[model samples]
Target: MKVIFIRHSEPDYSMLDKAQNPQAYVEFGRDLAPLTARGRLLAQEAAQNPLLDEAEVIISSSITRALETAFYMARHRAINLLVEPFFHEWRPDLDGLNYTEVELALAHQTYMVNDGNLPSDSPIRYETGAEVKARFLLALKKYCQYETVAVVTHGMLMRQFVPLDHIDYCQFVTCDIDL
Candidate 1:
């Protein structure tokens, strides 16, 4: 089987900051961030790839950005679109409060230094690359019947399992997998 891992287009993160309920945004509303106009247009353009034409199934992260991108990718195609949480972004463990980019970067630094593990009493642990890859592999097993599968997900999560220097918006990496 062939798995096409595509990163979602640029998301309008400013929406999260503008949200009335920042607490809710920190919790789950973060997943509701939509793609920017440029992102939407670029995603539509990327969907024109002939490689996507061979996809028998289109799987997307439950996040809004990915789902919207999936719709564009599907276009008028008759392929089935499946929303799965396992394909979601690499969510970091954050306090239920608003945060700045610098704070997030510091937390990430701490997470990396600890090797994704912290003291049992510590409240600063994050998911490791290994953990992310495991879940992604399991998700693939669920749809082994499909010959070609297109997954629209976040770039961070893709880096966990994909060996690439960088993954830009709407970038796709194809891998042949035996299931």
Candidate 2:
């Protein structure tokens, strides 16, 4: 089977100041935030790809950003869609920190870290990098039972699995594997 994994578009904080913590989203709740105006336009451009024109099924992470990105593509192709929480962004606990603090916290971690094994005492529910990889592999195996599937999820999720040097803000990669 053929599967296409597409990372979601740029987030509002993509342009935030260095002091801001962009990785704060590791601890986000299940709120469905709409795309920024530019994000919407980027989604449009991503949807126009010729390969996407042939997509058979569209699946997305339950998170708002990923869902919104998938919705845009579905609208363009007039396809039915499915939301899978297994594909949701990695959720972590970051309690008490205001928005600004979270952003700053993440900036330091993002470049210094490739993966995380959250501490056992973490207050919030967090998935280890290993857990994230395993879940994604499971979802991919389950979804590939169909002929062709398109998955829209967070860029970090994609990076954990696929090695893209310049990770596309909203980009698609195709691969076939037995696992």
Question: What is candidate 1's lDDT per residue for 96-120, written digit by digit as tens?
Answer: 4444455556556765566554446
Give the TM-scores of the predictions, in the order they appear. Answer: 0.84, 0.73
Residues 95-153, candidate 2, lDDT per residue (tens digit)?
54433445535533642253456645543334566777788888777675587788898
For candidate 1, the 10 contiguous residues with the lowest summed lDDT are 94-103
Tell me how many residue pairs clash in candidate 2. 4
Backbone clashes in each candidate structure, one number apiece? Answer: 0, 4
Q: Give candidate 1's total backbone clashes.
A: 0
Q: How well does model 2 score by local distance difference test?
A: 0.70
Clashing pairs in 1: none
Cα misplacement distance, residue 172 of candidate 1 (Å) = 1.0
The CA lDDT at 163 in model 2 is 70
Model 2 TM-score (2 dp): 0.73
